[model samples]
Target: MATKKTQILILPYPIQGHINPMLQFAKRLASKSRHLILTLLLPTSHARSISSHIGSINVQPISDGADQQGQQFQTAETYLQQFQRAVPGSLDDLIRLERGHDQPQPTILIYDSFFPWALDVAHSNGLAAAPFFTQTCSVSSVYFLFKEGRLSDEMELPHGIPRLEQRDLPSFIQDKENSAHLLELLVDQFSNLDEADYVFFNTFDKLENQMVEWMARQWQVLTVGPTIPSMYLDKCVKDDRSYGLNLFKPNRESCRDWLCERRASSVIYVSFGSMAILKQEQIEEIAKCLENLQTRFIWVVRETEMAKLPSEFVEWNLSSGLGLVVTWCNQLDILAHETVGCFVTHCGWNSVLEALCLGVPMVGVPNWSDQPTNAKFVEDVWKVGVRAKEDEDGIVKSMVLEKCVRAVLEGEKGEVVRRNAGKIKRWALEAVQLGGSSDNNIAKFVTGLALKD
Candidate 1:
């Protein structure tokens, strides 16, 4: 008798952070057994760019309603309006086609919490649904708390996940500028979570133990992450080193050899992820500080943002040999390099997890979203990094940048930060190793998928 294969459908919000972790988890599940078939549902704008990278998964494009180029949409409101209207119908039709064909019926849909509409699609068709939250457990805990009607004018968390002021609320709920729909949507995502049979978080028990404990008191929350490449964690599968998901082409060829020239723990690696676009003055400030610090550094700046820099900045840095600047590089590969002494980041949770696993300390310059909360944890709770302070204009000037950089890379405080970062790194590795919490949870989830009728 032939055994039935578990068909898994993944639907990630079309963003780099959301896509990377989800794809990596897909690869992880595929590696578990040949009996699992992987499929990804992406918007038309992202489907082609990401399809070729995922080797084993079947890529299906769901209509997003605007031109394929995505030029017509500019703001989040406009894009969400289009996506919400387009996704359910396009996705329903695709499911019907799959059911009518030779393919196995999909058993479950794993989707990012931001796009709860996917849940309705799954339920309408009698498919099991799982909510895969891409946010750090700490940030999501804050959101969940707010959803419970526990948050009002009280900016400080009573349980103390991390010290957060009114300004540090989740980006959508923070200010007068936040859209009403966005705020309500975030709350509704948590409310809709009751429909999910299984919930997954892209975090590990050791990294955010308090937050994990808090959530477990209410519902079963599985911590199966720091969802990095399998190569870094279990080394369970061949050719699993890359997430195979990059919105921008990485320039690793230019960096591999250059990093070898620098001494150990001497270089500052700076990247603000794919979405942050710094003001021209902010770019100039960072460049001038990098030059004056006289430290070897590697900075990732897209070509589109070059105009924001001082004229000849690229040519001058190339000739000066003081640093290396490129459009992009394989971030994990670069961060894992021994020469990367410190990371200057926007404190995005994915970057934070990567750096923590690599034992790299940080100088956090938060821009928005959950970044401020992540930055606070980096500085206050973990003691693994220092948060760069911004002025009234919200600019982290050159001197402030230099001060924070030196504190993490050169000052007495840096010693403790490095030691603490190393400790966190060990804990992160332990969580994903054999018999670890994440390893056990992943195995349990896989088994549950096969058994669920």
Candidate 2:
């Protein structure tokens, strides 16, 4: 019999945040001294961007023949069905193709937690399939909590519970109807987790021990994050680096140059993430709030127009030259810049990690989904940021936003938060160093799977 070759293939869910950590994992595995070939499967939209970042690896785009028009699919079911149709036999086809090549066929398949179909594909082919949970371990634990019926009633309570209660629960679980559907899906999916050869979390063990212990009891779970080391290694091997999904034009250099001109620890960087849609009134509120602070600010607003703000407010900011607004900014580069003292963010996991890694304090205004939970982690557990309060109308009021921003930027509390953020940044860097928690976990994960084969 011919010797089976060792290869690893990564399939990430078709979203920006989901794709990033998986790409980091692939990059790490590719750097290993072992002779394992690595392949990354991404949406066509992500392939070009991911391709530009790494070399000597194959980026396979799954082409779902849906109309390329701007029509969006709202639910996961519809999106998965569309992709299934477009990439009908692609997974199996890829396996067969690898086997026919002079090189080895893939021995392990690592896929996003949301892509359950990859689990079935791996099982049928007798290959190890590891599920990568892209969110923090706390978020994943809360998910399993809801699955186990521990979080249902507490989630329904109106108010006055501890911040941990609200934050630990997944954001979708807050809505009764959506939570019902989400719980059902989670239960069904989690039941199959035991069959998975290994489960990978993009977090460090020191962050969420309770959840990590729970997950490990059921399946072999590894805590290998914040995934920055892998990304840094990938960058070291390349001379040219690219940013953003290849779709939008990037303004990274401009944002960095603007930061260069500002005083140290003076600029507040604001971004609502890639998918948040703020109403006109909300935009006006935030714009006015920034004006009230009179601080140097760089805000990334993705909308085509900004008619919501008062004309006077815009004029004052423009005249003072204290604020620069762009439709989109290069977030990573901006966060890493030394002059950026604070981040007013939507609390996406990737943004949270980036800010923590760079030791920048945050003012979290969570919009939707996992953001609320992520925001809670930043403020409650990490002590590196504060949460902005929403008004009676459920929108974050301008005054409250301003207060939070100023508190994080200039107040005495701001200094303490910044110091703590610096501590966390050191921890993040150490986690990815040689023989660190993240490094050991990845090595053990790969070796365990290899032995299984």
The candidate maximizing lDDT is: 1
lDDT of 2 by residue, 224-255 (tens): 88765344322432322332233456686778
On the 0 to 100 scale, the lDDT of residue 123 in model 1 is: 87
Report the C-alpha displacement of residue 276, candidate 1, in angstroms: 0.6
Error of 1 at 157 (Å): 2.8
Show pairs that collide, candidate 2.
none
C-alpha RMSD (angstroms) for model 2: 3.9
lDDT of 1 by residue, 151-240 (tens): 766566645486567656666667536657877766666877777878899888988887788777766689888789867656766688
Highest TM-score scorer: 1
Off by over 4 Å in 1: 67-71, 152-160, 179-181, 312-319
TM-score (C-alpha, index-matched) for candidate 1: 0.94
TM-score of each model, paired residue for residue: 0.94, 0.88
**Deviation of model 1 at 175, angstroms:** 1.6
